[model samples]
Target: MIARWFRLAAVAVASLALLARPAAAQQILRDAETEAFMADMSAPLVQAAGMEPRNVQVLVINDPDINAFVAGGQYVWVHSGLIAAADNMNQVQGVVAHELGHIEGGHVIRYGEGMKEATGITLLSLVLGAAAIAAGGAEAGMGILGMGQQAAMGKFLAFSRAQESSADLAGARYLSKAGVSGKGSLEFFKKLQNQEYRLAIPQDDSYGRTHPLSGERIQVLREVYTVDPAWDKPVDPKLEARFERIKAKLVGFVSEPAQTLLKYPESDRSIPAHYARAYAWHKSAYPDKALAEVDALLAAAPHDPYFLELKGQVLLESGKPADAIPPLREAVQLTNQPLIATLLGHALIATENDANFAEAEKVLRNAIARDRENPFAWYQLGVVYEHRGDLPRAALATAERYSMMGQDQMALRSADAAMQGLKPGTVDYLRAQDIAMVSRAAVEQKRKKK
Candidate 1:
């Protein structure tokens, strides 16, 4: 799931409940390879937007629908379906640049305020409607959207035509400045044009409904590409290779083993083919076959951290935590990636050795420092603290986990317990106090509403 709370200063944590709520529960997908590829595509667009790449996160939602949107100005949620639908990395990058246009143009805030005023529904509700659309509850979401439209002049929360035009123009500029083509944006709109005619359900046409492709928008993009110098820029061969692997991996993990095998027959000896087969074998519960395929991958790219990480994941999931450690440790050292570090910590904790437990605590703490928004890291920290008989620390970690997840009541209860065990004025104690104060206020506010 997407981490509901964005990491800010500690002082900002207490104000979370007072901030806007999400439209629906977030279902975020975390994968090292996929995320890395997304980051690669996003970096140029983010830079072209005059924004810090670190400040903009590209999050993948697990839903299988062609949808993407910017929420909270910090996150861009792209459905896995969009990636699956894309024919090239540039197509995906075009979408990212467009969303960045929304962020850079400050359209989200302005459009949100306008929609709230026009529709008389909180922006959160509209977001929930979008989530419903993404989750295949199109009929339900359209009903909600229809209510908003009927309330006003059928505007609902969709972006105004002027705003869409501005975003399209900005997106083209960003892509051009980044030495990427506007062709992808044009092609995507062409694809949407086809969908607009073919798709029956309003909300089911996610990109069409949200993006609202127009002849003018398509014409404008076509003009931009024709005049822009970057239009003929060759696709980055390395990026294409990575995108292919990512698609292959996604198919292997998300598709049935039979389908995966059929797609990647034994005669296909390419790296991506082998990678897909490995995951397919693993998912089919044939660890030996999986290991053999992974070994082939390791032999080809001996130092590839993802391959090492995959080996560790396969071994760990197959109930060999001890054997998992060596590869996981190597992976962490090679990459120092937060996700891999967390996985290594999980393997360490699972081993249940005293020395391994202590090491796990250190690794988890470091991972949490870098990735504070990851509740899994905090939960693992709690597990480590509990193993070491540190109840106070464990309680505080649990409070943090619940707090980030927006579970104010549970956060308050855990924070209360933590505060009793911890000394006053310490960092943990102060954090616990903040959690308790904010969570208690939220609970009381909820009660008053009831």
Candidate 2:
């Protein structure tokens, strides 16, 4: 199962969306398998861009919009819709290449340059308009103000277009350097071109838009890509196979059960089809059907950690936590993935056996140690602490989870509780104090905003 977390971040200009807005809260979808796949896919391109693989992150946003963006760091956020829309892994790699260009070029950091230029134009126009009004030329003042606004907009749009063009070129160069074909990059641009046609977007008027027309992008990229040595190279078969499974899994997870079933009919019987149908069945509350699909998958690849994880999730969510333990335990041992370990810990705690509490505590603590960003693991750890009658530590865990979810008021209260209960000058007491201070500051900031 994919976990969802809320985080506040800025959405950058390197998006396919026509309209732009300020920083906002976004829902991030986290799954061990999807994240691992994205990391693997983007690693080559990240290295080609002269960055450490560990430093660059590819995050999946739980949005249905067909877009990807860099939010002011070495982070590339891809909408789930983009994955559903892609035909193959190479197409997504192409997107990764382009976003890496934005990261490497520091476009997000330089975004202020364009805004400053546009603001200057608008301010100048305002001064001129004021002078005209003072001279009693009211009509001329209004006309000057309107023209100035339009000119300022045009200036910003032009600057944005230049950045987009530069990123495209840089992306092509990175793809070439990585020995990856640009065919997928060109093909994805064509997909955008077709989408523009479908949406009845104006193709000729590039001046008013933030991005260059997809047709223009294709035309420009095609020239560079066609000459690249890797243009005709074939995608890796193993990687393509993984992409297909992930794409199907995402469709099943995000789409309506009926739509998933329709898209991956029972008659198909392939691994990806099985993956899709299993989720569809599970979501529809037919555990038997879902288990049957899982069994079929296990028969095909018994050692696959993800399939085992899915089986465990289905069993656990279906109210059979005891039954879910074996597969989930195996999944944890096989992968040592924090997400899988979190699930296993949940299964242990859900069993309600006091003997299982120690194991659950250990498992949950280990999972949180490796992935401190996982709010769910922290919440589960809180549950374990409460079950063991450790109120102070439980409150601290609650604070940790709430802080990650941006619920600062709740975090502040929990941290306050933990601080009062714990011994002064101890590590946990100090951490509780730190949380309290940070949460109080965040709460005050929210009050000011309101």
Candidate 3:
């Protein structure tokens, strides 16, 4: 039961980069691109909302169509297509402002409420259903709608036009109040209107599925912007560059392998073009070609960890775990990331067998500690613990993971293992009592510590 509907922001590039950095892991340039752009565009609007810039995180989905949404109370998700297609900073700001309107006006919470009433599941369960979908999809690497919730696949996308319109009205006002160009919101909707007509031929909910009925909405935006004049801020070229690079990188990951390989770079006939080709060929499983391409990239920028990490991932995926070792080790030594540590743990388990079990176990434990939110890490930890003959501990870890993930059946199995291992009147049960107390406190603790 994969939920494909929880798409509100760009969640894949960072997740992939975090998972794959063995020899030369590169930070996702796309999310960083969106965040940097949003940071500049959000100033006026956030100032108006009376919120801090750091409290907000802007991310781009690898998706190429126009769309935006908010997750929970933070992190606005914009499609990279929106970034590529935007004419200026004002248009982008308008999109951000619209989503901000949802958060500021509690439209996101409303959607959750509607869905809960519709599906009879808690908000946290909905998020877990989405994460389960993501982990399952990881078998195919990365592509379009990676963050799309598993629940969406179950035909459960629930956002009414009223909610969409409310968000839009609130968005326009937020833009005006924040002194951003409110008129740009109208212009943004107008483009979507034109896109709607162009889409009348196919009619498959390209951008207007949740944000429905663009024609009338476009008029409403126009009226609002005309009446209120907000600051007309100019677009930054650097932001545009980041946007283009994000598309290029996403295209690197999701485009048809052969098609991507055929795209040649005009800037540098040697390095960048080859780097692009390497991505396609390696992902397509042509190891010799990937090796040859990486050799060329290394010749141009020998110390670049990004290229090195890519080459390492290719090697590991190609059934050459030994070949993947040196570069991945080098990458870890360079970055000190728990992400690389986890990848290395996997490599050791798959390739080194029993020889490196001790090392893999230790590294993965550290990785889980650093990022418990990664369900994959928990899954891997269970595997490691099971291998060590600690079946009861393995079951507990897996059950805890499933509990966190909202997979009650799987969690129940794991929890049963730990409970079976327990004695009636002992410190083990007492320790469990302490954990429950802490969890109760966690639910009641609303404010973050300073």
Candidate 4:
């Protein structure tokens, strides 16, 4: 199921931007469940590349383009569209493995260096355009739109054809070492090639425009993989099923309800299809139907954490926080995922039951310890503290929440309030001081820009 946190974070511009390239023209999606799923699927490839799985961050970009790229250190940004468009697990895993190849080869640093020598018109205009897109998206695109198609493509295209071929070989090796077939990577490239052919007339210069592609790249990939013994290995059915469910979950939440229904109709009795329809029904205001569908799913796999989470989320959002507690608790127990634990904490807080207040505080604190970047968990911690009448601690938690949301001014205020009552040099006091310092810097930076 699509985590409610992502839906909430989507509308929050400042918070969302901070999680991504800060001031770059990229849209970074924040979804705990989706990210965890991607990480699980890509762990083997990352390990095979001799990289730490924890160090490699798999970020989702909220774009409809069929592209994946690596930027900065240990960051792989996959477009939501690519995931939704992928036919199976291997296709998506191939993309992940390919991007990992770029990282392992240190292509990002080399490309950045190459960009330094690109044509001035392309360089300056693209930088400014990216900033504009980062700052205001469509509203800011107006100024750079006139820069024209040439400048829209970033300087990273300066990557040599040799680099592309090298990445193809490296990616195939990683896949082979990880015991995964390389066929998906080949298929993905051909998909791009087919797209290039269809748009051969107008040339939609969106994604993959920077990457050098040629007939030889495909031939090289085919030649490299065809000889490997693992080339024809079948994709694991369980892994494939997980990918299908995730793709369906994303479509159910992001696509129009009518469209979702059309894609997964009543006759489609698969778990993923039902999962899709449950979300569609929930989104379309058919609450009873949504619950019914979820209940049916539970009948088949009652202990499934994700299914339990879906039930909990549906109930909680539909104004039954008290009712939402049991399944959320069960889900948390089964999965031990901090995301689900955080959701359960939210449900506990929403109930406003005096008896649940302490439990909520404990739950939120544990969640924050494990997933500190989650703004909602911090916010709920503040809510719990406030309910307990612990004003100073409440303010500190509020400050942390505001800091995560990129509201530095509010963070400063809350931190200052926290400092007034928090004990000197203690953990809470030190945290508040850190918040004050960071917020002061952020506020000053904004003022200077204006």
Residue-level lDDT of model 4, residues 1-450, one tens digit each, is 010001112121211111223213655666556777888899999999999999998888776777777756887888788888888889888888877887899875675454444344544655666788888685566456444233423333333344555777788889999989888877877777777678672344333333455344577778878888889899988777788888888888878999999999999989989899999999998878999889988999988888899999999989999999999999888877888888899999889789988888888888888889887888888888888789999999889989978899999999999999999999999999999999999999999999
**Top-lDDT structure, candidate number:** 2
Ranking by lDDT: 2, 1, 4, 3
Backbone steric clashes in candidate 1, count: 1
Question: lDDT tens digits, residues 112-226, model 1?
Answer: 5545554444344467668888999999986766554444323431445456667778888899899998877777777666675685434332242334444446777787787
Candidate 2 per-residue lDDT, tens place, 222-279, comes to 8999988999899989989999999999998889999999999989999999999999
- Please, what's the RMSD in Å of model 4? 8.8
Q: Clashing pairs in model 4?
A: none
Please give each candidate's TM-score.
0.84, 0.94, 0.60, 0.83
Model 4 segments more than 4 A misplaced: 1-33, 119-156, 160-164, 201-209, 214-216
Q: Candidates ranked by TM-score, best first?
A: 2, 1, 4, 3
Which runs of model 3 end up more than 4 angstroms from their true locations? 1-65, 71-94, 111-191, 201-242, 262-276, 295-305, 333-338, 353-355, 422-450
Report every candidate's CA lDDT: 0.78, 0.87, 0.61, 0.77
> Model 3 compared with the native: what TM-score?
0.60
C-alpha-based local distance difference test score of model 4:
0.77
Worst ten-residue run, lDDT, model 1? Answer: 8-17
